[model samples]
Target: GPGCVLGLFTNRFFVLRGYDMKTYDRLNRILILLVILSFVMAIPAFAQTPSSDPDEKAYEEAKQDAMGICPPIFLRDENGNTINPVSRVNADVPYSPKQTCGKCHDYDKITQGYHFNQGKGEKMTKNFAQTYPWCTSPGQYGGRW
Candidate 1:
């Protein structure tokens, strides 16, 4: 009797030319067993328990839930007005990133960061992974923005 094979693979028909039904069933069962084994083996890699101790893991989870996450606070301008630039519809008008961001954060401190300085002038002790060609000379790693 010729029939469709359905399980792990697609509903494909194996031609029963010389092979019997018993052999086909056994092969299908083997394929299903292999798929199940593969899934079982891959479970440990995906299911990370974080900590070894169950109590500690539970405590860490509970602490995260208890502490919770802070909601984003909508910032206001110096005039006590809510400064939402997204609401403004203008094609010609261009807003400065520094001026807009400085309302909540210090823009001056951000300009003095590592990226601002020239790559050749700086003397860095740490080895940066990305700066391979430029900083390979001596003691250098930082890049110019």
Candidate 2:
């Protein structure tokens, strides 16, 4: 009974055993023709140039405007004093990057990022604490090597 039902459904849909060799060959050719047509229709979309879009052109221009070589900068120490390499008073003092770059950039905000902070104030999980006894936090600073 099950096999008869399956045979009826297959014959009705021409899915398995109902089609003659000629019908199957024609259906295969039509499927191949449709696939080729779809690829042909997609050719123009793939061939479009990036500069053809006004939005993309504007984005490229803006990106180019933002990226450039840095100009010469005066290095400053922790106390905001300019460090002259040859100056006797500043000869042995190390230049502080925070004071120098912080003049134009937000040092605090930049350092607050995950990469710079390295889990300094993050919570320590019980499993992590048990695994790395020396680590005080879940990240690189106090956690795994």
Candidate 3:
């Protein structure tokens, strides 16, 4: 009687058509086993420490060294004139970052970097060319957005 009641309850609420109690029990056991396996697999990921890669270690050290030692910045205009905010003559002109930061940094070399270039002259793969016919390069500059 108890087995019949349980079967009726499972069938009514769970709507497990054509599956007997044994099949339902097996499915439950399989689901439980899969959940346990997932947790077991994730343990190694949770236990991981910082990376041992040389490049990553160097990047971290450099980041730490550069944290709070920045000097005051002097904003300069396109013609290498210092932009005094209260001055009337060059007050309206926009300060050029290339002229300002470029005093210490190389503008040409920095703009030639991967991010700024954005695949402007890179060769496209055959599959990518075929798939995206409008694209001339792999990145945003020459490729269709």
Candidate 4:
């Protein structure tokens, strides 16, 4: 009797330690639950949702499919005005994040002595965030380029 009981319980012990019949059924339920959880976790990758953010997703989808992508970020043009030219994102170059044109002016605070004067059709202007009537456009945001 002892040998039979030990043999019968040995596999159950190894597979689902300390579980009685009812508890073993519950343990099996949990194993199934874990498998289901893993299955659900894999769904998002296949969904093929937009890129990093909604705007980015919109930009890529609209690049040619719907409305065109918003014109590329502007840099200075022939007459010193910010002009948006058609340029593809350079995959070969390193990526840098730039939100506003003024963000390009790296040495403004240090180069106060050489403030660039506009000598062309477009006048150069800058905005300090603290100033009132502040504009969020490229030049208005302290854009350097």
Instruction: Name the best candidate (by TM-score).
Output: 2
Candidate 4 segments exceeding 4 Å error: 1-11, 14-18, 49-117, 120-145
Considering only N, C-alpha and C atoms within 3 Å, which residue pairs clash in candidate 1?
none
Residue 62 lDDT, candidate 4, scale 0-100: 74
Best by lDDT: 3
TM-score of 3: 0.33
Judged by whole-model lDDT over C-alpha atoms, candidate 2 comes out at: 0.70
Each prediction's total of clashing residue pairs, residues at least 3 apart in sequence or on different chains, is 0, 1, 0, 3
For residues 1-145, what per-residue lDDT tens digits would candidate 4 score against the true structure?
2222324334356446555566555655666677789889999888886567889877767776643534445454333444343464332342232323345545455334333322223433444333533333324233343
Between which residue pairs do clashes occur in model 4?
A: 101-143, 102-142, 102-143
For candidate 1, write residues 39-116 as lDDT tens digits.
Answer: 999999989757878999899888788667533444445444455556753423444545556666787887676654
User: What TM-score does candidate 2 reach?
Assistant: 0.34
At residue 28, give the lDDT of candidate 4.
Answer: 55
Off by over 4 Å in 1: 1-13, 49-145
lDDT of 2 by residue, 16-122 (tens): 56676566556656666777899999999999867878998999787777665444577888998888886665757778879988888898998777776697878
Residues 5-88, model 3: lDDT tens digits:
324344334444666777656666676677789999999999988777989989988877776555567678999888888666
Residue pairs with backbone overlap in model 3: none
TM per model? 0.27, 0.34, 0.33, 0.29
Which runs of model 2 end up more than 4 angstroms from their true locations?
Answer: 1-67, 86-89, 119-145
Q: Give the lDDT ranking, best first.
A: 3, 2, 1, 4
